[model samples]
Target: MKNVAVVVQDGAEPFGLGSICEVWAEPYHPDDDNPVFEFVVCTAEPGRIEGGSGFDLFVEHGLEALETADLVCIVPKLDFRHNDPRAVAAVRQAADRGAIVSAHCTGAWVLGDAGLLDGRECTTHWRHADELAATFPKARVNPDVLYMFDGNILTGAGAAGGIDASLHLMRRTFGARAAATTARRMVVPPHRDGGQAQFVRTPMGQTEADTLAPLLAWVSERLDEPMPVERLAAEAHMSPRTFARRFRDETGTTPLQWLTGQRLALAEELLENSSLSVEQIASRVGFGNAATLRHHFAASRGTTPQAYRKTFTCLEEQSA
Candidate 1:
């Protein structure tokens, strides 16, 4: 929220650490009005830290830096399988006290080392998910998601997933506007649902003629309209069966699943930024009715539309 401590150890992956810094350590810009964190790069043993690459870094702060941090972030390191006891203890202590503790990629190992992953749903890079599961049998490892939160602990998948995770935190803490501002400055998507898959089975189509992006964009604009598989396939100029197969191959989710997620996301934005009634929002997002919207909200967000609106509407109001 305010103070962020990114824990880096020897053999740290530069990109993971850099992503954390980019998200939390950005300087204030008058035009952006985003939260400016007191970000510190700390280590268990502050001094020369070897990077995963050939480069090196001279870190100044030690574990003490985490004592007052609102967020404790564990950066991925090459030596993930082996966690330093001092670092593990610090992270555990931070989480025990209710600070938001997050790890990116193989950084989940440190949380595992601290016994924080036990009985909690978590994820790492797909390549290391099985290893993480094998190493910590008690942890419920879900390798498919880009990122997930089990209480105060957040785990992100791989390298680029760090941006998704960090921006998500920004959105949760500050509001969607602040997160979008930060993301705009960083040149990244404002939000990618944590439930999104880490990888699709096939490479995304590149050309405008080949890609489904245009169709997706078209659907996003007309979410309130009925879009059965037949309708969508007709719009895409393909058979329903082929369209469904291509959709799964490209998006890693079924068309219905994708539609539900998009509708929910649109509903959230409307809840925060618009003065629409719940029924209106439900209709606009294609949930059909307030009851349907509430049903999906309960199943997906674990909170009712009124409660979510109250929470984020206040944030938006305060920001305004």
Candidate 2:
């Protein structure tokens, strides 16, 4: 987590490369406690590399920088169908030596070329999902998800999905609070569940007035209250059936699913920022009981509440 290297090859997408730098190489933080990664931009071939944007970038570091990187990030390249063998080898060697290797968008093709995607769950932009699956049959390519974290390797979809994936790595390595701080600085949500679907078929010509934004904000504030769809629909001044349909159309998820995500996010905030007991936190977040909270928390986050607290508890408070 301390050392991070972003691998850029010729025709690299600028935004994908910038996303890694935004999350890992940002110089200042409002909290002053964020992890400072020793960030380096490295390439297989040093000197001027052409970018997808019809510009060139001067990459000073070669593959040697990846040897000590705790995490190696692969930015999407325009010509991902073919990768330089030297770059592929460096990526494979880094992963083989236990460094976390992540790919953004078509960069998964690089992992596939390196044979790192074999037997691993992964994802990429929906446009390229079929090709990725066809090329790397052993890789379980989930087209619906924004990102996938299987073992030490992570794969993100396109564009903003890279930010989501990188922030997730920050959360896992640092803590929820740190991740939240970083997201706040970037003005984005800290943790978007990786299971969230990448595409939403919004109704054409949808006006801002028809949005469920107000209702969503209302529900988030009242997470501790009873929130059956009937009640929620009433609050939105719509019939239950219409509300359900509109919820899916607007949010790309069911009402209950969105509520659960919000509750889980609240639970995570409490877990990081407060001294509330598990039972108290569960009640506060409307889970009603510790057992129920534990079940959902483990299922969604891959860790129990107690374990999460142990790993992410504020160090100063613990020392005090």
TM-score of each model, in listed order:
0.63, 0.63
Q: Quick one: best lDDT, which candidate?
A: 1
lDDT of 2 by residue, 134-180 (tens): 99999999887788899999999888889989888888888988889
Model 1 ranges off by over 4 Å: 193-320
Error at 65, model 1, angstroms: 0.8
Candidate 1 yields a Cα-based lDDT of 0.86
- Candidate 2: which stretches are off by over 4 Å? 193-320
Error of 2 at 137 (Å): 0.5
TM-score (C-alpha, index-matched) for candidate 2 = 0.63
What do the candidate models score in CA lDDT, each in turn? 0.86, 0.85
Per-structure clash totals for the candidates: 0, 0
Model 2 root mean square deviation, Cα atoms? 11.3
Q: Mind giving the per-residue lDDT tens digits that candidate 1 earns over 1-320?
A: 68999999989999999999888998888999868889999998889999999999999999998899999999999979988899999999999998999997999999999999999999888889899999999999987778888999999989988888888888888999998998999898796533433142212222232468899888888999998999999999999999999998888889998889888888888887898999999999999999999988877765678877775686648576
